[model samples]
Target: MGIKEFMISFIFTSILLSILFIPTLLTKSFAGIRPSSFSGHPQASPFPVSFAYLISASKGDLESLKRTLCALYHPANYYLLHLDLEASHEERLSLLKFVSAHPIFSQVGNVWIVEKSNLVTYRGPTMLANTLHAMAMLLKTCKWDWFINLSASDYPLVTQDDLIHAFSSLPRDLSFIQHSSHLGWKMNKRAKPIIIDPGLYNLKKSELMWVTKHRTVPTAFKLYTGSAWMVLSRSFAEFCVVGWDNLPRTLLLYYTNFISSPEGYFQTVICNSKDFKNTTVNHDLHYIAWDSPPKQHPISLGLKDYRRLILSFAPFARKFKKDDPVLDKIDREILRRNDGQFTYGGWCSERGESNATCTGFGRHENSGVLRPGAGSRRLKALIVKLLSMRNFKRKQCR
Candidate 1:
């Protein structure tokens, strides 16, 4: 071939390659780069306070888990998702992929998956263990004011902005846990029975194994029980995980054979410890609707329960059906999130020419800014009433 012909062919090939690679280059450029906030600033300020969340899910709850994560996600907070060992391999893998692929999660680097899953048994100490496990991981890896344990079946009634804003002025050492020394029927039904959890030693999941012999109630520590869900202050979480004092560890052994240990473990621990007992706020901060008589589980909420749930002024609610219509109402009204997007907050803002919001990195300087809405006011009112002298002192360790 002639030299001229060879040179012309080489130039044309180079042009073709550049054109093909332009899209690829554009996509790669955004990798790990923080997106700009809506104000055209590089990022928005963070909220004054933050929460570290442990979101636990069992088999067949992948969709609900994803929805809950999206709704609760905020750049300032940390999240650890735990899919029970009983969940299918596909479900666990899909959840991991969703967290990894999420553009905002990748950049913020706050979301995590408990790759080493635990076999959890309902109403057993294993449930309590899972909560503690996540707490330990979060304590080791992140710094936050509070640790919130939620299940896939639960949904947020307020946005992260509203939550942070409402909590900003409150005492930092306070723990929002519902507890009472009065055990009622649980004293006989839950405490007396000695049971074993197979999940502790076996690979398979099973119900608690009841023993023929019953044990007397203890004098070492008072037994307290209430809702399993809670918002624990970092100081209290450290006490449970670190156990500088042996109370947390001692009670853990006692509750090992107790029924529904998750409901009592933290409650008993907080109430028994002098350092943290006064910090207890005696509210779980979740709105749960019980049946007329109340059963093993709270009733699954629907559109009909929307008003009551909102008026309750709780930040979170539980036992919702997957993709329930009431959740849609929350997205449209309370959260201002459309279709599976993150709830609106100061750290994230809508960018022009892009449908995505909060898919950006926020500057440290922008931290502590809040864009709280009506939900914030409602939550503030609830907090005020709870912290009132009549309610706060009257409800503690009663």
Candidate 2:
């Protein structure tokens, strides 16, 4: 079946399923809210804001995924980890075991694994599907102000405390997405191509299959494209999933055959919708270096990129090699994280103590104690510049 027909069939099936499950969802009691163990050091931040994260990885990425999760973990945030279906059962099991065995993870109950993995083809609709799947799951399970998508290769330049503090003052509706209407070379290379991803249906992975026919650029709604990495507000995320206006659903079907749908799906949806277009911040909030003539992939960051990475003041950076020394340097200097431990945050440490180890929750009086350090200050500066009068409105959806 064609992409549009497939989407229609899937929607019909989903409607039926929703009909079957709606009563149960409404009547069934959710898992009991476990009281904060608050038995150890209180790891709560003073900031009220929380972020839900979707971290995606593929085969041979377990180690880097673990490290990235550790560096980004905070009691206040929610994390959903997706290991693509291309990974072996053994790897998935090992990852599951690791998450289950982590004491703090159990105590906090914020981390989750996408038990049924999706088969993801590079630059295909499956990548976008996996992201939306995680978003749906997170939306059902947690309360968060924003949703941020990262890959296994991405690591944080700032702690969760720093992030929370920086975002505390910002308007909740803003979405940090790098987008542009000018397709330039992409007009012919990407917009007109009709490619099918077998990963959407097949058990095994395969490259996107291009058809003999090409499609005209979409005119019903203007097409916008940009970095796949983004920070979306909770309201925007809900709009995409619920799709009250049908724009998100229509664009999803349209982008099914479009290459690198992840880069454009949300962009097109947000910009095309009058409610969200004005909220765009025009930045992906990631520090990444590409070669002079960029290749298929971005440059793998190492020690050489440290200064530039910090100076950029982005919350995250990507495409690092597993166990790179630069990661250790970041842990030591930027995050002050000990080996195999969560990043230092207010929830884990004492108020006045210097270099205090994060013992666990319950020791501090309030779970919302914030220990935003120099990183928070740096991030705040970046955010101020992004939202400034001269930069903010001028950069929206243009």
RMSD of each: 17.0, 4.1
lDDT of each: 0.80, 0.81
- What is candidate 1's lDDT per residue for 1-398, written digit by digit as tens? 34465345434423422232122222221112223342122124346788989999999999999999999988778788888889999998888778777877766677788877888898877788778777776766667889999999999999898999889898999999999888888878998987777787678997777766678989988889999999999999988877679788777767777899999999999999999888989899999989877789999999999999999999999989999999999988888788867887766663232233554544432545567889999999999999999999899987
Error of 2 at 76 (Å): 0.6
Number of colliding residue pairs in model 1: 5
TM-score computed on alpha carbons, candidate 2: 0.90
Q: What are the per-residue Cα lDDT tens digits for candidate 2 across 1-398?
A: 46676556546533422332222232222122222443122234444788989998999999889989889988778778888888988988889888887788777677778777778889888788777777776776667899999999999999888999999888999999999999888889899987777776688988777766677986799999999999999999989877578787778777777899898989999999999999999999999888877666999999999999999999999889999999999999889887788788877787676583554654562647888998999989998999999999998888
List runs of model 1 lying over 4 Å from the truth: 1-45, 350-368
**TM-score of each model, in listed order:** 0.86, 0.90
What lDDT would candidate 2 get against the real structure? 0.81
Once superposed on the true structure, which residue ranges of model 2 sit more than 4 Å away at CA? 1-47
Q: CA lDDT of 104 in candidate 1? A: 74
